[model samples]
Target: MMVFTKYLEDFLMKCSTIGRNSATGRLAIGVGHESYESSHLQPSQWYGEVRELCGLANRPCTFPCTNNLSPSEAAEALNDHIASICQQLPPLDTTRLPAYLPARLIAPTVSQFQVLQKLEKTRVKRGTIPLDLPMHLIKEFAMELATPLTSIINASLQQSKCPSQWKTVFVTAIGKTQSPSSFGELRPIAITPLPSLLCESFATDWAYQDLAPSVDRRHFGNMRSSSTTHCLVSFLDFVLTHLDKRKSSVTSIFIDFKKAFDLVDHITVISKAAASMGIRECLFP
Candidate 1:
């Protein structure tokens, strides 16, 4: 766990440095493009002086400013801030699982908790899980119930089974504010157990990264850090820019899959993906 924290801090430091440089470049470009009226308001003239007056001029200013702290200091401050926030949040109630959860769904073991901790340290994607479980609470709960949880999970796995409770999901519909009862006005989202999600994430990362390069680039679904809609828009922009420049004609087709997840056979998809990559071993194997 300490090792994970150390690595996380180091990674954040590197990210901070990259972010600072990017921000600095953007600031310069923005200043350069400013009108002559605002030319007298040079950032270097006031940014440093104001920051110094606020006691925030010290290395690692919490808020974004020109006079920023060293990467290490910024990382440390970030780590401490996260830890403090987690400490203040309510702890998870491990004594009872959620309603309708299977009896076989046991609490997590220390080792399993460790695995979850490591997985949490990895890059998280947006819109994955709804619940925000703090790392500190996760660690505390894992330690409190490690032995029994370990035994239960191991027995279930040895029997080639998973707890039915773990597979249960809750879904909610969010209205798009267009009209009350319109079919297209609601977006349904599924919320699953954090433990199940953590396990799935570990497995998904391994398979996805391995197969991503070999898969067709145009099929952007499920690719990490890539958005299908964004790609489509970018392609459209490219085509339109060139068409306008050269006065050429271009045709485009748009396809929409309604409830795509509900219609797709995931097993078949994985099998076909493996075949496409020319791999003999089953993805699950």
Candidate 2:
């Protein structure tokens, strides 16, 4: 466990440093909203209303605008919010994490509606029977399986061989739009082994929280407390301010990659990471 955590911390630290150096002159931002169409709405017009709605619901709203304020006012509020969140976050401890945090092992409780909604959204065989397993049963099985799984994973880590079961995944295609009958517009979703999935999910969350503070705020692809809207607003504010001050046009370029994740070479990524972190041993040995 100590070895695993140290490896992750060291790797992430190096990755963060690489990210910061790479983003020296680049602007990165996130744009997140519950609804994708919300992007079309002008921030100045709907910011206050959405903020008020979020306040009434007692949740953190990621809307970029606040109180329908002017650009300067909105910029100030956004900066203050970012600063406050950054200040309030607890510092990451690099010594060692507990071998097994029970909270991390536990699966999140979901309501029946949520479960049904997920089932509805899943693109499985027409007339497929959904699993009737209860949360308690899953939890019990996970708890019982943890010891052996951990031992296997640790052994594999030492030997550099990943367990075959962890690599198995079931792929399903879901339509991009409502009531689509064609296959071309469908998106592929991979369903992985539950235990492995849960472990990876927990590890991802831990890494994100642990490394977020040290990561460059400009690089916002996958970090905690940052969203697409936040990125968009920040960039927009900067552009507006620049134009107003210098009365000069700004050039912007957008690049979209298709199947970006599928195109990545995992071996290259792992090799680069190992090299960057100075891990001399063969990762797969």
Candidate 3:
């Protein structure tokens, strides 16, 4: 797995170098948004395996391997990835603009109406009783429904007075997706938060607190040893501030890089890791 992660790390260094330069070339230019639906397989397990082999815990990403690559190689790889991103969109000039994130948020909302519907059903079920219902039981149901609604409403009201500063961006440089069909889809586009503001939750929030105790001791030890939350939050804030400045719409692509970890080209990743470490790419390749 470690070997595989090395390969993937190299690939990302190459890609990031490719992409970053492309972004710089047209900085003053505007952007636009596009809406489309695509399907793919989820490749997170593969990514995870490779990451484990590489002795990585938590979400595996490219930043760790950056230091290992030469400045020139890193720049080149970033250029490639940037070029890839540019290839997907309409041409941009000083006038045209794109807002990519909003469209991305909407697409998932459209795709998951069914899940939301299930939640509604759950809400209904929670309200119902066997007709031999106890009054106290009915009261409890009412209390249950009230809690989430109250929480949401209160949070909103509290936030109302605050500046609408939800501009955080979480970039998933590579990711995987699962389709209802037999196979999955994969892509190598950077995925920011739909609103860009909810990135805080992605990076900082604990989705479920109760499960922590049950997790393996090895995993816990790993978590303690390998943590980057503080640094990530600082970077997230920086990107959000930078991205939020666009006056025009930006093209945000919320893509699922299916089996991103597994599908990573091992040789490419290894090369990147080796380069980062001041080892010659030729030797590793």
Number of colliding residue pairs in each model: 2, 11, 62
Please write out the lDDT profile of model 2 over residues 114-160, one tens digit for every residue: 33333334333322213323444444454454555555544554444
Q: After superposition, how far is residue 229 of candidate 2 from its true place, in Å?
A: 2.5
* Model 2, position 154: C-alpha lDDT score: 47
Question: Model 3, which residues run further than 4 Å from truth?
Answer: 1-251, 279-285
> Using lDDT as the measure, what is the rank order of every candidate, best first?
1, 2, 3
Quantify all predictions' global Cα lDDT against the true fold: 0.50, 0.46, 0.38
Off by over 4 Å in 1: 1-116, 119-136, 142-160, 182-185, 228-233, 241-247, 278-285
lDDT of 2: 0.46
Please rank every candidate by TM-score, starting with the best: 1, 2, 3
- For candidate 3, the clash count comes to 62
- What TM-scores do the predictions have? 0.47, 0.45, 0.18
**Cα deviation in Å at residue 54, candidate 2?**
23
Candidate 3 C-alpha lDDT tens digits along 238-270: 667777887733454456764445445554544
lDDT of model 1 at position 266: 47
Sliding window of 10 residues with minimal summed lDDT for model 3: 102-111
Deviation in angstroms for 32 in model 2? Answer: 35
